[model samples]
Target chain A: MSTPVLELARVTVEFPTDRGRLRPVDGVSFSVEAGKTLAVVGESGCGKSVTALAIMGLLPQGGEVGGGIRLAGEELLALTPDQRRARRGGEMAMVFQEPMTSLNPAFTAGEQVAEALRLHQGLSPDAAFAKAIEMFRRVRIPEPERRARSYPHQLSGGMRQRVMIAMALACRPRLLIADEPTTALDVTVQAQILALIDEMKRETGTAVVLITHDLGVVRDHADEVVVMYAGRIAERAKAADLFANPQHPYTIGLLGAVPRLEGGAARLASIEGTVPDLMNPPPGCRFAPRCPFAIAQCAEQPPLAEVTPGHQAACWRAPLDTLLEQAA
Target chain B: MSAPLLELRDVAKGFPVRDALGRRRGAVRAVDGVSLIVPKGSVLAIVGESGCGKSTLGRLALRLIEADQGQILFEGEDLRGLSARALRARRRDMQLIFQDPFASLDPRMTVEQAVAEPLRLHGIVPRAQEAQRVAELLSRVGLRPELARRWPHEFSGGQRQRIAIARALASEPKLIIGDEPVSALDVSVQAQVVNLLQDLIRELGLTFVLISHDLGVVRHIADRVAVMYLGRIVEEGPTAQVFGAPRHPYTRALLAAVPGQGHAHAPLLEGDIPSPINPPSGCRFRTRCPYAQPLCAEQVPPMEGTSHLAACHFQQNLPPALVGQDAETGGERLRRLQAYFTDQTQKQGELA
Candidate 1:
């Protein structure tokens, strides 16, 4: 089998707080094969964003990262700050959630994208400018030349996001990490952006690490899925398998919580309690406090075990019906 | 049929756009000639993207913002005809829950005080019973009474929303309007709030107006839905009908645009929604609409249908693919997903 384009093994990110070190992302491991999308799904503080930032070496101050991040079999953690800077936008790129904030207010969209091209690819001024326009047109921006000259404020949210994507993909990196790419856009615009990303990935065969909280998007867009809870992987599987046969109580609760478009008038089964505080996370399963199928053995950490072929879950009573029947 | 609990007739509101020099630069029609009826004890969701006027319409219903034109009738009484005092008194029967609980709630005030202020203002309960009423309202929204003494900032997002809902329910309102109430919350927390709102509406027999951009949440809680575009409701109907077989091209596009619908590849409308200041002369959606024709540009299409109204000329002639009745049911997918949980549990039981 061909090696994965991007691989993360036992990645852990800890931030020092007043009380102690708060481990936001604890021992997460996943891989994105070339041309395939791997989505890390979770709610706020689940360490999905932190993991993305850690991979990019953009963790905030006081953050300590441990474990391995390999880009095309190259150890990313071994690279110095200068080397990491060179790798960003050349070998890998990231698209942030908020386009308005991510973009520079003073510079025109064209200038910004051109700057990325020139910095990463060492293209001449005119060549970089022309390439920026081409990237804009490729992203389906109407009136590419005119839009390129327009500042970020002059463009709409969707247009700005297109510019961001154009900038991220200017150098044609082997890997693309989009963190909530469409969260700020409208539904119609979101569809367009998602399609654009997918099209880009297909054309370039870039391995994509899509980080989002929306399960619906993950179901449609991702080839593989990793469900995160309280800085830990709750479940990981192929998209179809995970959606078709979610095993973890947290995963089940998440699926049950989302209101299906066709499911008529059924009360959603909400997962009780908030996410565990990462600074003082639970010892066993991070989700044990809220897991309906939690047992005494859950007090001790449960290793992520295969529930079905290619589907893994970290829960003591996964395939919860057997536990229920025994209890009955 | 009995009179609608709330009715909006050709309601229109426009705010003047001013230049840097304070000169008027045309008007931006936030809500333009929108008409709808909310039956008693029904959950009516106004779904749309930002700048679609759903929030504006909700504010108009409560007279929080005055409508420049048209009639707003609540309980068969025109809100415009009511005197200031009468309006103030009537406000006790109608309440609003905002999207940002922290912003809506006063930081200095405790949850108890925030909830009790409504009761005290409406005189719904005597001064002595105000505390008890606040406790009841808090419990109704699934909040602990003990937490009422805590300030809004001390609470979590979901808890803050519960406090907001408690405040909304304090006056024993007959009608409640929530403007993107759960949009800011986490999925798990959002579900809890959605369930709480559904239960509250059913148990209290309150008329609900939910303004949201989320179609998933709308499908869960709403009985009827109005799909707003630009500043008008292009389609309005029962939730099932609107979702299952969207007639208007825009509605179809909106539904198809939903993630996991398998229609992501199919391009919907193109370009951003046109600016409201200079909306398209005829159909506001015509500029971006793929089915737009010369007639669509020349004349506005009148809304058609008895219960499910759609403001589009080509709605009747739309292709089957646009109207998604033949598409795979999301319920089937959900069932398949749910079966995984059940199947796993069963397999585990056998092992045990």
Candidate 2:
């Protein structure tokens, strides 16, 4: 089997606060195999975005790495700032949530894309322009040549996203990290964008780390699913198995909460309580406060245990297959 | 029922477009030849993509923007018959909830002031009783009455929307038009707001005309659904019929693209929504319609229906999707969505 493209082993991101070194991500581990996809899904401030930002080495100021962040066999944590800068857009690239702000206003769509190629590959200006235009074609940007000179404002919301994808793919990174990429896009455009990424991954065999709160999007795009709550992995499994049988209460709650388009009478089962304050995380399973199936043992931090091969859930009732079946 | 509290008869709106040569070019038809019957105390959702005349039709219904052609009837009275002052007086019964809560709310005004402003302006209640009325409205929409004292900046996106809703409810209107109300909110938050709106519809017995880009929200809130394409309603039917078993190809495509719509796709359209200024001949959706035939391009498809309506000529020819029958399979359908998306992904690769 091919080596994993990106791996986070016991990765935790910490910050120095007035109280103490508050850990935002605590001992979380996940990997993205080549040509595969892993989704980190949870509500806001659940450490989904933080985990992605940590992987990208784009953590906001005052953040410190407390564990291993490896990309293509290299220890990213050990790399200097300049070296990491070299790593970004060369081996690993990030596609952000908001394309409007991520893209520059002054630059034409082509110029912005070509800038990536030129900066990374040191291609001649003409060569870079040609390559950027080709990338645009690959992403299915209409009238690639004509759209090349157009500014971000000139293109529609979906078209702007295509441009962002073009820029991300321009470098042909080994690992692509998309943080809520389609959250802002309309449904049709989201389908197209997801398809674009899926196509790119198949063609290039690039490993992708998708971070989003949307369960359906994760189901649609991911090969593996990582359910994150309160800066910890609640459950991790293949997308099919995860959806077929969600183990964690948080995962179950999330699945049950989503309103289906078919219009059922089933009441959305909201997981009780908001995500705990990251400033002072709970001692036990962070989801214990919200978990209906939580036990006294869960008051002590539950270890991420393998309930099944290729599937792990950090729950005392991890093997509640029968209960899950009943709930579904 | 209730004589269709609000109605639009042959309503259309167009704005003058100027060319580079500084001459007045052809008018941009924003909403064209649209008609709707918004029954009292029920929710009617207008679902469509951008430039689909949904918003314009929504505005035309309330006369927020005047229709260049056709009639707007409020409780069997023609809106145009009334003088400006009389129209303003009638407007107390119809209020609009805009798409963006951030932009809709007055920045300078406190939530209390914003909500009570309507009460004061319309003199719905005694001037001294405005504060109590505002608080009651706030709490009704699931907001804390004390929140009224704070500014919009102090609240989250959902909270701001609640304040907006509170303000909309201030007039005690019979019919409320929510233009993409929950499209801007988070899923969990959206569900809360959607539920709140549903509760409002039931409790207040206020008629709702919802214009939204999110069909899921429509599926939940609307009694009847209207699907628009290029300034025209391509399909309109009972929410169940339109969503469970969508007839039109365009409607099917829209459903297929919806996140949990049981049917997923490789996005049937290759290009953007066409310029309404130069809409395609025949079926407006023909340019991007996946199942468009030569006949579709030759002659315009009339918006036809027996009891419910659709404008697609090949409605019967298209493959069946759950339009009205979807409610029974809601959970099962979402569970199966992963398979559908994977299938589309495969098709995309194969097509590519």
Candidate 3:
């Protein structure tokens, strides 16, 4: 589809733990087209955020990136450290869950936005300042002139998040990676932020990689869904298709566990097991330990195969048609 | 037909808020003019955003913090008259389960010690019986009884929460008030905990007061739901009615806000929530109210109805046929709202 804006072709992110080099993101491959949102949903420690960090080239020390990372037909892995730094804000940006930490307390929100622009674009001092104010306006910050001088401590949680978004969008990056952007926000504020992000994507046509643990957020805003479990893509499909028919046992368990809005006062279908540790995941299928319908074949790692035209699920016993039927 | 288990009549609580100068300039009206009843063996969920005072209302109901005004009656007993010792006795019947399991537990104490502390405090059982009671409590919450010797740190988030539940049940409380019990937990973990609570409710016939922001959780556990705004209940009803067909504009807006509801987003509630210390002149929601008329601005909507309640100037079910209309508009309006917001911001940005 016109060369995906971003692609992780069999990417693997590894870390040096006490035991040895452990792969947190194992042989994962996915892509996002410009103007579309690809949601990665999973429980904690499912390598959701780690995958996002890996894309942004912001991995901490002692961690290594293995495999392909392409951005708009260009190999990001081949880029020099300076080239990667230059590419970051001007072409790609991120907004973390907690804005309080993501933002610099020493600087005003406007300064932070201006700094992002100045570093990547080399804008003049006056021009950078002006752009910062303009970016704040784009994020719907009330009284941009006044807020430009106010420190991070002065803003509310919602406003602080707006500033973070402004910083991420200042240079109009081709890709915006939001990691649990609204996790700390209230429901109403969350609605506003999601609406804002959706609007920005349509206007800028910037591809978005949304990483979150909330299924509702995925349902509301995402164009495509990539369900991950223990460092691998367990299921991948269009958002509409995934909701209509989740073929993976993990996906089914996640949907059933949540209290549905439309259903009659039915019992919540809870998944039975805990999320596995990525450091020492199961030998075969990482999810087989938790799968209710795990068969003898599950002991052999099942490759993520297309269960439908565009829907892929990595499960040995999940009847593709049955899950689709129940969802309908 | 019997009297409700717990009732709060015109309850209010105000906490002194200090200004930047360290002077107590005003009091934040956390919970104001709230009234509701919890039926015997039924669950009542109080739902709202932060600063709506739902959590404070819960704590106030238990007299963990005394209400500045209004009456809290527990099965016809006035909470105000109870002596410290008598209140301690009543604590055995009404227990609170906090939202953060890690924060609530003692890191040094083993699970066995934590569970047994309540038993020792209430003097519910003798020394020998304490061990047996601890094991039973552990098993009741779906934990292996032998793992009680492990410290809270050894358990996962879900397991720690289960331990907390086991400790709460040590007193065999007739009423359990869970304050955002599962908000901090994993969704799968949340489901298991919710299921365990439901099972406990059915088996013990214990009344419950659940305070949560997640509407789905409320819908699952609550027999009745109360919608709160700026410390007051704007709507109350049976779970099905409240969810299936919310009457108030606010309730309708909330139902629309939930993703996957297939509702058109209407400019995602404008402006930040106003300070509770200075609520709007009339309706607290009127500041951000889309349908606010001159009447809404001048007068406070009466919180009305018996079996089901809604506070609004024009509130006769909003032309009943209009129900489920939101489900039809779905993503189109959401897309439009997103575009509008983005464009509007762009203009605002250009202006600056």
Best by DockQ: 1
TM-score of chain A of each: 0.98, 0.96, 0.95
Report the lDDT of model 2 for residue A296: 88
Pitting candidate 1 against candidate 2, the one with the higher TM-score is 1
TM of each candidate vs. truth: 0.95, 0.88, 0.93
Descending-DockQ candidate ranking? 1, 3, 2
Q: What residue runs in model 1 are displaced by over 4 Å at the alpha carbon?
A: A321-328, B263-267, B321-352
TM-score, chain A, candidate 1: 0.98
Put down candidate 3 lDDT per residue, A1-328, tens digits, no spaces: 3999999988889999898778889988999999999999998888889888888889988778888999998999898888998889889999999999988899887888888888888998779989999988887888998998999998989999998888888888999999999989888888889888998888899999999888888888899999998899999999888877667777877776777665443456566667777777778899877665567888799998988898888887655444334534
Report clash pairs, candidate 1: A319-B344, A319-B345, A321-B345, A322-B345, A322-B349
- In CAPRI terms, model 1 is classed as acceptable
Ordered list by lDDT, greatest first: 1, 3, 2
Pick the lDDT winner.
1
Which runs in model 3 stand beyond 4 Å of their true positions?
Answer: A263-265, A322-328, B263-267, B317-352
What local lDDT does model 3 show for residue A271?
Answer: 63
Residue-level lDDT tens digits of model 1 in A1-328: 7888999999999888889888998899999999999999999999999999999999999899999999999999999999999999989999999999989999999999999999999999899999999999999999999999999999999999999999999999999999999998999999889989999999999999999999888988999999999888999999888876677878877887888777553677677678877778888888877665667999998888888888999888776656545644
lDDT per residue (tens digit) for residues B143-238 in model 3: 888898889988888888889988999998988999999998888788878878888889999999999998888888889999998888999999
Give the Cα error of residue A201 in candidate 2, in Å.
Answer: 0.6
Q: Write the per-residue lDDT of candidate 1 for residues B1-352, one digit (tens) a residue.
A: 4568999999999999998899999999999999999999999999999999999999999998999999999989999888899999999999999999779999999999999998888888899988888888887877778887889988889888988998988888889999999999999889889978987899899999999999989988999999999899999999988988888888888877888755433555678888888999898889888888899989889999999999998887777754332124324444444444344433443111
Count clashes in each candidate, considering only residues at least 3 apart in sequence or on different chains.
5, 8, 0
DockQ of each: 0.48, 0.23, 0.25
